[model samples]
Target: MAYELYYWDGIQGRGEFVRLALEEAGAEYIDITRESGRGRGTGAMLAIMQSDGEALPPFAPPFLKDGDLIISHVANILLYLGPKLGLVPDDEALRYVVNGLQLTITDFVAEVHDTHHPIATSLYYEDQKEEAKARSAAFIKERIPKFLGYFEKVLNQNPEGSDYIVGNALTYVDLSLFQIVEGLVYAFPKAMSNYRGSYPLLAALRDRVERRPNITHYLRSDRRLAFNTEGIFRHYPELDIGVS
Candidate 1:
């Protein structure tokens, strides 16, 4: 059965990570939120999330429904999809490691969202302009290095002697990390200007993931959504430093 991915209609946001895995696996799936006409739209997604029929209702977007199984959370969704897509290893221990990495990416994504909506998501970015600037400055200067540095260390310490995040082969975590780096670079080009040489392993991984036939095609295709202010990786000039 084809997977049903429920996420926001327009933006890539957190859903792009799942899309990358699906595309790479050549899996059959429908982006339910983006599909318009005849009961297929954002309303369909809301229906699923709001359904009381299910014992467990998803609290947010980007949930995946496969057959009777519904998985929520980016990390949880990937954890379920990983082995099915061959984006993770068969080894149980390794899967746990990948889960940890994916959760880290989730944390990083939250911080990225906070950079734009530093004070509150209920308020507009313009409302917290000054706070966002301060938060983003610290994010660009301190948090970026801390998070990126941690990933760099992981790549450097990989016993497989390969650049892949979990195993010698590419896993879903690697794909998710690629999306994180891609969004961050797009959202903060100036801060990430030195990302390549500084974090060579992660940079190389991003390059490799981008060159993958399916991912490359997906990125260039209309199916792929562009990054925008409405999404997690908003490119506000003032939110960034150095290069304007």
Candidate 2:
């Protein structure tokens, strides 16, 4: 049976990471909101969020329905899909290593989200622009380097080689890294460009992930949503420079 992916229909947001992996692996799945002609728009997401069933629901978008299992949380979802999709090795040791890397990625993602809404998610960026500026500064000056450095360390320590994050083959960790790099570049072009050269392995991995046939096709197709302020990683000029 095909998997049922439940996510806000609009803006790639967190869902894009899952989408990229599924597409890359050529996994069969149905995008629920999209099929109802209610996906791919912000309205669809608003409806999902406002629904009373959300609390008991998966807790967030990017959840997947596989047979009787309903899974949420990006990292947890990947942990479940990685094995079934053959994106990870069969070895228990290697799988745990990849899961550890994934949890680190989750930390990085949360920090990224906080850059724009350091004060509170309930407040709008315009209302907390000043705080966001301060947060963004810390993120670019300290957090980005630290997280990137950790990933670089992982790559360097991967005795298997810097070609992939786990063993000698492609894994969900690699895909998550690609998403991180892409999101960072999109949300902070100047900062990302300035520091990108320092991490050659990560840059190469991003390039390889993009070149994969499935990813290339999805990106070129209209299915991919362009990044904008509506998503978690919004690019505000003032926030980018620690002003306003």
Candidate 3:
């Protein structure tokens, strides 16, 4: 059976990370909300969430439905799918290490989301513009360097090589890091202009992931959603601070 991925329509959001893995692995999956049918579309996804009969209800979109199992959260979904998709190594110890890296990436993603919605997700960007600017300035100055630098260090210290984040092989974590780089560039082009120089190893890894045959095709195809202001990584002119 095809894996069912449930995420909001029109934005890449958190779902893109899973989508990238499925795409790269050539795995069969249905993007539920993006399609329309009797048991498809955003309504179907919401119905599952709203259903009282559901024993394992997901708190939000971007959950994965594989057979009778429902996996929620990007890290959790990726962890479950990694071995099956051949995106994660078989070494028991290494799997935990990869899961940790993914959880860290999840932390970084939450921080990225907070940059534009510092005050509240309920408030509009215009309402929180000033706060967002302050938050983004701090993020660009410290958090970006802190997070990206750590990943760079990971790549630098990798026992296998710097080509991939965790092991010598490409994992879901690499796919996710690619999305982070892409989203950051889209949401803060000016701020990330120096990313290549500052995070050279990460930059190289991003480039390598981009050049993969499946990834290259997926990126060019319509399945990959573009980063927009409506999504997690919103670009406000005032929120982007240039490198000092």
Candidate 4:
């Protein structure tokens, strides 16, 4: 049976990470909210969410329905699908390591969201523009280097090789790292202009992932949504700060 991926229709949001994995693996899945047909679309997803019969309801979108099992959260969904999709290592110990990396990515993504919505998600960006500028400045000055540098270090110290983040083989974590770098560039081009120089290994990995046949095809296809302000990585010219 095809996996049913439930995520908001318009924006990539947290759903893009899961999409990257499914795309890279060439897995058969349905982007539930994006389709228009019987048993598809956002309403079908919300019905499942609002259903009282669902004992284990997900708090938000980006959840995956596989057979009778429903997996929520980006990391949890990836963990569940990784082995099956051949996007994770066979080694038991290495799987945990990759999960840790993914959780760290989750942390980084939350921080990225906070840059634009520092005060509250309920408030509009215009309402909290000043606070966002401050938050984004600090994020660009300190957080970006801290997180990206750590990943670079991880790549540098990997016993397997610097080609991939964890093991020698490609994993979902690598695909996620590609998404992270891509989003960062979209949201803060000036700030990330030196990313190639600062994080050579990661830059190389991003290039490698982009050159992959499946990823290349996805990038050119309509399925790959363009980055926009409505999405998590919004580019408000005012919020961006160049690297100091």
lDDT of each: 0.90, 0.81, 0.93, 0.95
Deviating ranges (above 4 Å) for candidate 1: none
Question: Which prediction has more favorable lDDT, 3 or 4?
Answer: 4
Give the per-residue lDDT digits (tens) of candidate 1, residues 89-173: 7789999999999999999999999998988899998899999999999999889999999999999888886579877899998
- The per-residue C-alpha lDDT of model 4 at residue 230 equals 83
Q: Per-residue error at 69 for model 1, in Å? A: 1.6
TM value for model 3: 0.98
lDDT of 2 by residue, 27-133 (tens): 99887777656353444544554678655565568777788677888888988888888899889888988888889988888899999888889998788888888
Q: lDDT by residue for model 3 over 80-102, one digit each (tens)?
A: 99999999987989999999999
How many steric overlaps are in each model, in order? 0, 1, 0, 0
Model 2 pairs in collision: 9-40
Candidate 4 residue pairs that clash: none
lDDT of 1: 0.90
Give the best candidate by lDDT: 4
TM-score of each: 0.97, 0.90, 0.98, 0.99
TM-score of 1: 0.97
Ranking by lDDT: 4, 3, 1, 2
Model 3: lowest-lDDT 10 consecutive positions: 232-241
| Residue runs of model 4 more than 4 Å from their true location after superposition | none
Work out how many backbone clashes candidate 3 has.
0
